[model samples]
Target: MQQKIIILDFGSQTTQLIGRRVRELDTFCEIMPYNKFPKDDPSVIGVILSGSPYSVHDKEAFKVDLSQFVGRIPVLGICYGAQFISYANGGKVEAADSREYGRANLEHFDAENPLFNGFVENSQVWMSHGDTITAIPEDYKCIASTANVKFAAYASTKQPVWAVQFHPEVFHSLQGTQLLKNFVVDICGSRQDWSADSFVETTVAELKAQLGDDKVILGLSGGVDSSVAAVLLNKAIGSNLTCIFVDHGMLRKNEFR
Candidate 1:
């Protein structure tokens, strides 16, 4: 069984980037909209709450019942995810005096904390949110902070929940990948075994078992996903697989030719 990380997307534009970074770390992850977050999954070792464009204070903003997996699994929140965790736990979030949308230095942070194990003091981080966490709940402690954002990051004293007010998925934030590695590898205890070879091997085996001697027809879309699927099918059933490509009139000039 593959160890997995679940990312609850709140419509953040960079939500996919979060999953991409996680996969790059050799850990498999799935991104689902907050409303459709799964309830029970034994393979899920960690959960990530993605940022959103909407404010946590907004009544119509996307919300989820954190109790579903808060204390049971390790959780890391980013940007809006951080504010939502604070706001949900009786903390306070308010519009910032100014919208922070660029690089900021981490003036102070808890070096002893596992989240910042390899992080250096005064390291740069990417910030891009309009709201800031003004106060944290009693059970949560501020673990990191910037010159502008007081509660730039916090960890729950009672639960396995940690959050950051910056965008760690983006490359602009130096040492961001290290932070993610600490969370997913050190804290969550995930074995970095998920890789292209592993995926192909596992997928091929499953395909062979489910499609044994069965002829399969695939639609080739000239895209990465479909092309990969075609390759997998070919590898599984050899001459039993048939591929059909359609000229949908949407291809580039002379693509059909």
Candidate 2:
């Protein structure tokens, strides 16, 4: 089975961007709302907590029960997500006297860590939150920091938890994309082995097994993945396979024209 990554959204503006970034790595990923996660998917290798507009000190701010993933799976938190990580695990975060926003250079980064694998020291990172992580849980260790924020990036040496104050999914983050690639490709130890060619080959065998003399129809989206899937199915079923393209009005400009 193809390994997958799950991004848990917390009402962040760039929530969808995170998924886009992961897909660029030639791997598949899905963004599920905080409440819409599937209960059965062992292939999910990691969970990313998105930043939110809510402050940790606000009584009406969003809250969730993360006990399910704290110690079991790899979890990464960003901005408000990081704060939540600290608070949920017995750390501290409060309103900053001066809201730190906009461009800020990271002071130091642990190059040995996967998050900083391709990142150079004194790299510029995008920051966009008011709350700061003052203290971290006993299990978490600070890996990188800027001048204004002491706990910029942290990870649990004991568990599969990682958090960062910067927006790695944003274009403004100079080395942000590299950081994400390091985490997903290196830290997670994903083979990057999943690809459209593999899918096509696998589906061909599966289709031959199921539809030897039977007929089958595939709804193709003209997408790379779906196109490959269609070819695979066709190779197995031959004349028995039918390809149908459905026209939907929701596609971008000229997508269906």
Candidate 3:
């Protein structure tokens, strides 16, 4: 089975970027809804908790049982993910005195930890959270900090849990990719064997097994998703695939063409 990372999306604008960075590390990763957890699947090597637009302190904020992923596999949380893990783990996540946005410098980080293996002293990082992790559990310790934000980063001493208040997926953070590399490659022990060929091979095999000898019909839309699906289905079943382009007759001029 191919090893992969799972990123739980909490509706952050940069969720896709996080997946992109992971793939760029030559590792396969899938993003699922925040509340969804792939139960007992061995293909998963690590789990990432993504940031959210809503604060962890919000009455209607997104919630998930951190216990679902923490001890089971290596976990990395970013922005809202960091805050949520802290808040859920009996830590204190309070509304910040002010929104800590934009560039911040990590004045101190634990060099002994594998997560910060390649980090430079006073490294730059992007921060965009409305809440701060004021306190954490006794088993968890601060791993990194900015002059302004004391608890900019943290990790659990007992489990495979790590989190950062900064936005490492953004381009502004120069060493952001390195941090992700450290997490996905080092901490997660994921092999850099994911490739386009492997993806096509596995997906086509699954499609063939699921759709054997059965005809498939797909709506022909010129959009990215539909187009890609059409190609994949065509590859899987060949002549058994039928495409019906539904022109609702309400398209703008030249749209049907």
Q: List TM-score per model, in order.
A: 0.91, 0.76, 0.93
* Residue 69 in candidate 2, Cα distance off native in Å: 1.5
| 1 or 3, greater by lDDT | 1
The whole-model lDDT of each prediction reads 0.92, 0.82, 0.90
Q: Sort the candidates on lDDT, descending order.
A: 1, 3, 2
Q: After superposition, how far is residue 64 of candidate 2 from its true place, in Å?
A: 2.3
Q: Which lDDT tens digits does candidate 3 get at residues 120-149? A: 999999999888999987799999999988
Number of the top candidate by lDDT?
1
Worst 10 residues of 3 by lDDT: 246-255
In candidate 2, what are the lDDT values of residues 1-257, reduced to their tens digit?
67887888888999989888877776667788776656578887778888998998888777778876667677889898899989988999988888878888889878777678878778888899888888999967899989888888999889878899999999888988887887777766566776656756776887788778998788877777678777777788788888888665556777876
Between candidates 1 and 2, the one scoring higher on lDDT is 1
Q: After superposition, how far is residue 73 of candidate 2 from its true place, in Å?
A: 1.7
The segments of candidate 2 whose C-alpha lies over 4 angstroms from its true place after superposition are: 194-257
Clashing pairs in 1: none
What digit string (tens of lDDT, one per residue) describes model 1 on residues 1-257? 78999999999999999999999999999898897767767999999999999999898899999989998999999999999988888999999888989999999999998999988879999999999899999889999989998888999988889999998899999999999999999999999989978888998999999999999888887777788999988888899999999776678888767
**Residue-level lDDT for 114 in candidate 2:** 69
